[model samples]
Every structure is written in C-alpha cells, then in structure tokens.
Target: MKEKLARNINIYRKEKGLTQEELAQILGVSFQAVSKWENAQTMPDIALLPQLSRTLEVSIDKLLGYASQDRPITIYEEAYLTQDYYWGTEPNQACYQVLQRMPPTKPIKLLDIGCGEGKDAVFFARNGYEVTAFDVSDAGIEKTKRLADQIGVHVNVFKADILDYRLDQQFDVIFSSGVLHYIKPEFRQEIFDNYKQFTNPNGIHFLNVFVNKPFIAPPPEKEPNAYKWHSGELLAHYQDWFIQESSEIVFDCNSSGIPHKHAMTSLIAQKMTSLDH
Candidate 1:
C-alpha cells in the first residue's frame, strides 16, 4: 500500500505539473517530506490524505491504491431507510427565494445537488424549471421520483456522488444546501470550481455550508460525517463572482426535530461574463 500510494502521489503530482517543492508548499509541508513520500520512505499523516487526494484530483480510495468504485453507500442509505423526509417535504427557505426570483419567459435549467427526498427538486419542476436532481442514495432517488410522480411534475433524477458526478450540461441555477460541508475540506474547492464552470454566464449558484462557531457543538466523535467550514471560507472561494446575497445565521434543527443550534453560511452568487470569451 505504501509503495502504491507513493507511486500514485508521484503520478498525480506530475500530472498536475507540480514538483515536490511546489506540492509541499501547497500542502504546507517540507519539500523533503514530499520527496520522502514519493520515495516510499514514509507516508503522509492520515489527516493529510484528504488534502493530498484533493490536490491530485483523485478519490481517497484511488490515492490509497484501492479500486476506484462507487463511494461508500451506507451513509445516505441509512438516512433514507430510517426517515421518509429526513429534511422535511418543503423547499428550504434559500431555495424558495431563488425559485421566486427565476425569470418567467425562458425555461431555466436547474440542478439540485444532494436533492435528498426531492422536495426542492419537485418544487422547482412544478414552478416551470427544467430540473435535474441527484443524490447518492437509491432510496433518495426513488423518493424523488415518487414525489415528482405525485405532483405530476417532471424531474430527471439520478443516483450520483457529488465528488465524481460528471456535468454534461450547463445550468442557469445550481442549488446545494447543507451538503458542501459534508465534503472533505480539500475537495470542497474542486466541487465549487466545477459548479462555477458548469454554470452559464450570469447563472446563479445557491449554496450553504456549516461554519465553525463557538456556540455550535461538534458532531459526536463517533459520527463525524461533516466538516465545519472556517468563517468567511465560502466568500474567499467566490470572491471573483458576483455575490447576490451572503449571510451567516444560527438556527435550530427544525427539520431533524433536534433542538440543536447550527451555524451556517448561505450564499447566492452569479457567474460573471468574461470579456475574453
């Protein structure tokens, strides 16, 4: 495993056109450490694996010499199996606001990542938008299909992981709420970059992430399913985009029926038209 990881690190770093020194600088490690890793003399710390894989644009499984397959299916499957509407049946407030402001003349293309039970996807579809919704859970996709059927709305639903899902078409609006935080911090930037590239000119992205806060309690040690973003992290990533709205708020977990305080950063930004393009 060590030798395989060493070879992969070398291959991926070279593929990115980064030298040992460059990769070390990006990872905030010494060049010698990078050299040692590639030489198979040592391995990166467990915590550094996520960042390393992200920098290489590879999955953790692939970086660790495991066969690249579907991401672990247990997490979302458990959620769907245990709860019908894990996040409730209504569109979130952020999504609802975006839907209300959508243009009426043209049919807008919308993609809902982590669509969960499909409430938001169906809501947009019913509102006359062409919607494509996807989740990692089979049950979630089925629930989405059922919801669309019940509402007499059409939504193209599929099962996919956000990390590896390929986007063949651009969208006018991309909505992802309470989902980005679940991604490893290193991979979040790649996801954001993909969303930006997949958005049409002047297209908007509605995103929200859990942010670190003093008052917010950490997820239980045994259930570390999500990562808390640093304050202003989302803004830092989208600094060049046209920010339509941005805010930080603390709210109770009404959807989960859990009386816990949650700190979140919500943002709506539009891709800017490039003059060179």
Candidate 2:
C-alpha cells in the first residue's frame, strides 16, 4: 500500500504540473520530505492525506492506489433509474432567483455539478447561459442530454466523478445542489477547492450541503452514505468569499415518497475580484 501511494503521489503531482519542490512548498514541507515520500522511504502522516490529496486534485481513495473503477457509482445510478424526477423536475427557487439578479448584458458561463436529469441545466440554457452539466451516473447524463434535446436547448452534458474531474475552464457561475455531502467528509474540502479555483473572478457559487441536526435521522448502517456537516461547518469553508446568502433549514423530503426531515446548509457566495483590477 505504501508503494502504491508513493507511485500515485508521483503520478498525480506530475499530472498537475507540480514539481516535488513546488508540492512541498504548497504543503509547507521541505522538498526532501516530498522526495522521501515519493521514493517510498517514508509515508506522509495520516492527517496530511486530506490536504495532500486536495493539493493534487485527487481523491484519498485514488491517492492510496485503490482501483478507480471500485469507487461507488451504483447507488446514484439506481436512484436516477428508479425515479423519473428524483429530486424534482422544477429548478430550485434559489437558482431562479440568482439568475434573475445577474446582469442582463454579461454572458454567463455556467457549470452544474451533479446535474441530475438536466432540469436546472436546461433552465439555465433556455435563459441564455452557456451551460455545461455533468453527473457521475451515465444514466443521469443521458437523461440530461435527452431533456436538453427535447427542450430545444444546447447543454454540454457528460458523466464525471467530481473527485477526479478536471476543471479545464473557468465558469461564471458554478452551482452544486445537494451534491457536496454525497462526497465523503475527507474529500468535500478538495471538491470545494476545485470549485473555487475554477470559478471566474466575481463569479457566484450556489451550494447546498446536508448538515446534521437533532431532528434528522441517523445514517443507515447498511447504506453508509452521505456525510452530515456539523452546524456552521459548511459556512466556515466560504469565509473568504463574499457571502450573499446563507441559511440552515430543516425540511421534509418527499422525493422517495417517504417523508423524512433533512437539515441542509444553503449558501450563495461570490469570488473576490483582484484588488489590482
């Protein structure tokens, strides 16, 4: 396992165009320490794995040399297959409200992460935003493509896992709804880092993450899915950004036709523009 991790670290670092010295600088360690790890002479402390993987833009599972194909995909695939509109057909009210507030003359480039069935992507496309949407589930991407076609709107939809997804271009608005919590606790920060890096200056991020609350039921032992954030934990991640709106609310979820209370942290924040500009 140590050997595999060493090789993976080397590979991912090069993939990100980072030298050993550069990686060390980012991690606040000496270049020799980075070299020792890659050489398999030593292993990074367990606590550094999250930060290390985040800096490399890879998942902890991938950094440890687990088979990429072994990552969980079926649960989401089944969810999209079993339900016509799993979350709902209508776009979230917050999404609509944000779009209405955008300047009319500026062209918005939007990226919708975990865009199931293309509801919000299509809505944005129809509203004149250049939209790119992706989901880990192939079924979800296909459904999104079909919906976009049916609506006579163009949306670049694809299947991608957020943990390993590369951000080739920046976006004017990056929206993620009820998706961040689906990632394991360790990887959520890495995903957020990617979002911040790929968003254009002054761009807005609209996100909602599940949070633990007294009223919410405990996670099922058998399923073992979705990480719950502690109160105010999610907000702390966006402290440097210009917060436009934030709220924690408990609501009844009827998506599965089984009503259950859910706690979520919803936020809308804008990236800061360069002071020099």
Candidate 3:
C-alpha cells in the first residue's frame, strides 16, 4: 500500500515537472525522504495531511490514501507518538543560526514538514514566526498540540502526507531537519516544482539529507544491498536557485554511540525571484 502511494505521488508530481530534491525542500524534508515515499519502504505520519494536501494541490481525502470512511490516525499509535516525539533535546544551534539569517518580514509564516512532536516548530513559533507544523501521525500532532498549549504558544497542527498535499498560499520560510532522506525520487521532484509556488519569491529554504556512504554495522555475512547515496553535485541540476550553502558533516543521532549511520549534507538555498523557468 505504501508503495502504491509512492507511485501515485510520483505520477502526479512529475506530470507537474518537479525534482525529488525540489519536492523535499518544499515538503520541508530531504531528497531521501521523497525517495523513501516513492519506494514504499515506509509511510508519512498522518498529521501532515493538510500541509501535504495544500502543497501538492490535492485533496486531503486523496492524500490520506484511503477511500473508506476511516480516520487516518490510530488511537494507540497517537498515544505512543505524542510521548516519544517530544522526549528529545532542544533545537540544534546550527539550525537556529541558519534560520536567524533570514530577512525580516511581517507576519512570517513558516511550515515545518515532518514536525514530529513540535520541537522544531515550537522553537520557531516561540522565536516570533507564525508556525504550521504537520506530521504523518495523529499521535505526533496531538503531542505537539498538547505541548504547545502547555507552553502558551500556538502552532497549527494537522495530519498530512506531504507528497499529495495542496496549498494556495505561500510561506516566508520552510524548515525541515533530518526529515527528507525518506522521500522517494519521483515525489521529490513533484515537491520541488511546487515549493517555489509555495514560498514567497525570495523565501529561504533549509534542508538536511544523508550523503551516500557504506553501511557501518557488522555485515550479517549475508546482508542485503545497502541504499544508494547522492551528493551536492546532484543538486546542481537546480542551479537556477542560488545554492547558498551545501556541506557534508557527521553527527551523532540520539545516544546511539554508533558513528551516524548516514553522513549528512545540508543545503541552504534562496528562491530565485523570477518564475520564468
């Protein structure tokens, strides 16, 4: 079913002419995220439905990938997600520094794709941006919402699949961290085509994705194939957009003690003013 969803997302996004990296940026994720979605190895959480619908210019009902009258979110999962998503640390300094460099604008509207338990969203919201956060899980949304309420701040939360989401309005900035490596390729392109439309002409986009590398864990002696990886050179395809900064680094994820399994490449690109493309 997840694979079917990935295929459909790719078809619609390409009919529109978007690149995987482009889609990941708009969806506030990494190119790998779009790849994953296309491959059907996993699914986006449910709360991102609204944003996904708006971004993709599709209906929420269609985005959910469900035809039956069933709530996209499950109760048990919601309980678990809400608790787990928020149990992590605060926003990283590198992320904060990048966001602070943006030009000032009134009523700054921001979107956080794959916003987990609202950690990143809450950070931006508290710092004076109007934030809209979405995830694929209902539990995640509930947890984010509850946390926001406790903190006396407001963050619009929803369940959505970014690939199929549609939006008429644009944003001032879009942010996603450690999120895009999951998206499948076809859908990533769709997102790129739409991202420019979703942001103000000069809007800034911050993205983080994995750099291609070999696996670290001891091979099972008969381990399956490792995933293919990509780099900034591939991003050159979208040269029209000013590639502000693209770099590779290694960082610890959670307390795993293992050198990060995925080497990361981060991109900070500012949208080109002209839409003559």
Root-mean-square deviation (CA) per prediction: 8.2, 8.0, 11.5
Kindly provide the TM-score of model 1 when superposed on the true structure, using C-alpha atoms: 0.72
Q: Could you tally the backbone clashes for each prediction?
A: 0, 0, 51
Each model's lDDT: 0.80, 0.79, 0.65
Could you arrange the candidates by lDDT from highest to lowest? 1, 2, 3
Error of 1 at 65 (Å): 16
Best by TM-score: 2
Q: Worst 10-residue stretch by lDDT in candidate 2?
A: 218-227
- Give the TM-scores of the predictions, in the order they appear: 0.72, 0.73, 0.65
Which stretches of model 3 miss by more than 4 angstroms? 1-89, 103-105, 215-229, 255-260, 275-277
Which segments of candidate 1 are over 4 A away from where they belong?
A: 1-76, 219-222, 254-257
- How big is the positional error of residue 270 in model 2, measured in Å on the Cα after superposition? 0.7
| Candidate 2 Cα misplacement greater than 4 A, ranges | 1-74, 219-223
Model 3 C-alpha lDDT per residue in residues 1-277, reported as the tens digit of each score: 5654676666656656788888778878788978888787766667655666667766655644633124443223434443455346387554575466673346778888878777778877777788987776666777788778877889987876564454457887878775565455545665666765788877877877666665543322221212234777436535777877778876555333343344677777888777556
| Pairs with backbone N, CA or C atoms under 3 Å apart (clashes), candidate 1 | none
Cα lDDT tens digits for candidate 2, 142-237: 888877888899999877666556566899898888777667666667667878998888888888887887766854322445556787877787
Cα distance off (Å), candidate 3, residue 15: 13
Instruction: Quickly count the clashes in candidate 1.
Output: 0
C-alpha lDDT of residue 21 in model 2: 96
